[model samples]
Target chain A: MKFSVILDALPYLLEAAVTTIWVSLLGVLLGQVIGVVVCVARQSGGRAADMAGGVYVSFFRGVPLLIQLLLIYYMLPLIGIDVPPLVASIAALGLASGAYVSEIYRGALNAVPHGQSEAALALGFPGRSIWTRILLPQAFRISVPALVNELILLLKASSLISVVGVAELTRTSQTISASNYRPLEIYLAAGVIYLAINGALALFGTLVERRLQQA
Target chain B: MLDLSLLVQYGPSLLRGFGITILCWGAGCLIGMVLGFVLMLLRQLPVKPLRWVIRVYIEVIRGTPFLIQLFLLYSGGPSIGLRLEATTAGILGLGIYGSAYFAEIFRAGYQAVPKGQVEAALSLGMSYGSILKRVIVPAMLVSTIPAIVNMMAILTKETVVLSIITVPELMYEMQTMAAETFATFETILGMALFYWLLVEVVSRLGRRLEARVTRYLTHASPQGSSSETATARA
Candidate 1:
């Protein structure tokens, strides 16, 4: 590998890597909001709501994210919805991630014994307080590591957004490699950036798991 | 609304694409399982350096997106004089990518095998290979089949990314048809159904395998079976 090419492209690639991180962060944030809603709806004990949640999860989970991205990016314009590439990319990633994150949420919620909510209700706590104070906190603690796992997966998946012409880390490396004719060095450098980001995320996840265990 | 006639006309092309997709996925998973087994074995070796090297390989592969890995292999290999056909590159990339996850699954399975059983095998004068072959492998296989099936589903979806490198897989064919027909939604939805069916079949098979294998375990419990099925669904 030519070190010089990597050195020359390091700053540019890092800038694009920042874009990758932010895009993924935004996507996952959106996913969390959507996932929480779906999780709650599915748990609400209404048949129609449960079926809707199931359909949402299955459709998003079953269809590959790349196909979703392409569909959103291309078909939207055909139907006159004209969104920017970034919007389409984030929407696709967020919607797909919502499905997975909702599953994580459901798992964590289930792990918290039903008695906890019953106890809260028997204690005369307000309904909102029962969820926000009693159930959600416990579930959140149990779910942190899984959420982090999903986030790391999302961060890596953001690279697929490059297909829609987002100048993320992978696409940025491809461009630099094309210009410098140093595909090996450039891609290796890009891989290192990805590894660094994910390594930090994994370490953070472990820390959360440990702290949760101690708690 | 889907044009039923268009689907009928495109049925043959989609079937051809589906065949290629399965070929790539099957070949990739085969190579991946072998390499993953090797990696898991190497990780348990007494050599610290070998363990470290295997750990790094797994982390690097698992940390990054498969799309980047595919691009690097497909594009960078030729520059380094490792010329590979598009299909070869796609298969190699998928295999390497899947190996990391498979290695983890196998490692978990290895750890899950009760130590008492291995000890009993050793005390009975069984060779190490025999213990692994006769005892550990069977136990691990029974417990880890669900995880392996889940990985297969993931890898099957991953083959879609291979289309980027010009593999004539189902996704590539569908994308080509979409471009040609400009009926993006119809083409995409049809492909989605195909993928959904494929995943459903794999999942159902995993459940059946779990049911069959659990019968072989002495400590088979209802709770254990349910947990394994839950993991498969996840």
Candidate 2:
């Protein structure tokens, strides 16, 4: 209820929000890379590749991201990989987001009419160009909305990375609230910050979607 | 590099934790569906303020992370004179968080019911109760099963956030076991396997339920296009 508590905590929380954005952006970018690969594997018409892609999607999508984070954060040290908390957090998030992103790409690709691919094939276009030049552009356009949704979800899920000791917004809020004994105001401020970030992302997504539609 | 013996030492406690996880998930989902149904119904009312409030509620819940919500409820409760135990706060937070999504699903389900069919029913002198029962319920159920199932899977995963509040769910158990024995790989993998199985079962059950509902709806209607269209929309 104290306005001063929230006002004082705002600077720290805002600083940490930058970290949240950075982590989520990096995670989403990594996820898109992994997603494209898995999507290609799934669509390649090779049995082993398809199965590998399927298994990757199923395992990542099935398991909770928290456990995945803990697995990476803790298991790597045991194996002498020695990844930092931030790296492990991003890796876990990227690996998990890849599953969802691949599905989004798959849906977008399927939404692109099959006839377009066939027509390109009949025109003597190679399969590689058929995908890269013709299909991928359209599919990427179709995937923008879903990709934005995934990005927002990843931003929210990034709060869990606090478990691995990253001092993101949520963790920083926890720290300040514990010190100041104003959990209500601190958490409420954190939630509003999250809402603002996600709201802006949603608005940006709508603009991109509109631009794509016009194009 | 993987250890199996750690499972023997920690398996019983993990199983207990799994039971709590399932309990919280089941109870939370039930509360969510019921509350969500109420919210959906409230949205249908003509009161502008009520509808606006419900809209804001849905947006706020959907916009933020469940971990923050749980923190607010569990840590911030006493400030608002609403003290809650960790388990109670966890379940309540999950329910409130999930209700927003379920309400949207219910609204979508209602919208999916053809407006023309409702008009036709009204023109045929069908009462509101009978029309809802005979026409809307069946159609909505058929259309909403997959979404409902998907929400259930999501809720199951959200239960892991409950561990942050120290609810002693599967993740909490895994964390404790890992801390105690430094068997992070084994315990984390064990936790993942349990969650994977749970999610697989939920999705498989959802598929079965979808098939059954479609069959039932198709069998009830001679034209059968209703179920087909519903499946297509889904």
Candidate 3:
């Protein structure tokens, strides 16, 4: 349990933690967009759109994110649409997160009562405005907790991108541990950093949830 | 633009890898459930330190990624005078990681059981063991089936992380095949299909189990069958 090695590693690990955060934030944001699209497709009342959304959700959710990363990283080059490791990693994370996010949004949407939408309809609100102005706001409030959970999950999962050669926190830890021969302390330090980041995310989620409740 | 011939060439090895994945997942789930159950039981005891330790364990495991956990177990083992093979470390990591979640699920399920039912059992002179076996366990199972199933699906996916440790599971096999044949697309698609099937099977089995348990509970106990059905439907 040498403290010096961890102290030396802290700066590098923190830098890499930023990469982890940046990648995961992008992934989560992209996932939210994809989730909204899929949610709309699922609720669009057309069979093809519904089936397309269903398959997208099932395939992405069913397959592991690690495999998704590998698929994107490797398959893109063969198709002449080459992407860097970071791009592939983010894309994979976003695609996989989109599936889970869509499910969360669906649950939140369902929690919003049907009567609200019907009332808006009877009040002569257009369908688009009714959804965007009325229903989505309530559903967004309902989704905050789950969305936070997904973000934390994605942040933790960003470690998998190390497989594609991204110099993220986990990879930096691995590199340092290999060089320093202090796997236990280094990995534990990495774990602490992860815990700190995730704890803050959880706290933020709690605050948001409280705010939503008050509203 | 897609090719199917690669599957014919790599089918046997991929099948073997799939088997290994299933084996690891099964062993890991068994370990997780048993350990989680024990942890849940321990948490119920009136020991402050024990409860505190269990809470920390759950929070730490839930907060971090399983990849870091696996790295700690596999790479960090030698420092602690514990050296484990990749496969052993992978399975052990999955179990330890999953136990935290399962324990929480068990606790929640136990709490979901109505308080009056436990009180009635207590008043009827039923022993703690009997009440646990006849009343609490059944209701807990009915309530926790979905969560348990969800965790199992998660564990199934986590098996892929084992490949990072060179455990030769499905992902490892796919990567190896892709590197060798340059058939990355085919191998990746095959891997995806295999996992999709596995997850589908797990969810289907969970639904069936839930149905059977709900039916058994409905017939065995008439007092709260309606609410049980409502929960089951939900």
Candidate 1 lDDT over B1-234, as tens digits, reads: 767787788778878988889999999999999999989988989999999999989989999889889888988898789889998999999999999988999888888777888999999999999999998888778778888988988888889999988998889888888888878887777777777778778778877877777775646534354454345344
Each prediction's whole-model lDDT (CA)? 0.87, 0.90, 0.89
Of 1 and 2, the candidate ahead on TM-score is: 2
Model 2 steric clash total: 0
* Tens digits of lDDT, candidate 2, A39-82: 98889869999999998999999888888898788788887998
The order of the candidates by TM-score, greatest first, is 3, 2, 1
Better of 1 and 3 by DockQ: 3
- In model 1, how large is the Cα lDDT of residue A89? 93
User: Cα miss at B197, model 1 (Å)?
Assistant: 2.3
Better of 1 and 3 by lDDT: 3
Candidate 3 to truth, TM? 0.95
**Ten-residue segment with the worst summed lDDT in candidate 2 chain B?**
B225-234
Better of 1 and 2 by lDDT: 2
Question: A21, model 2: CA deviation in Å?
Answer: 1.0
lDDT of candidate 2 over B30-84, digit per residue (tens):
9999999889978988999999999999999999999999999999999999999
Instruction: Write the residue-wise lDDT of candidate 3 on A1-215 in tens digits.
Output: 79898999999999999999999999999999999889977897599989999999999988888888887887888889878899989999999899999898899999998999999999999989987998788888999998999999999999999988899999999999999899999999999999999999999999999988998
> Would you list the clashing residue pairs of candidate 3?
none
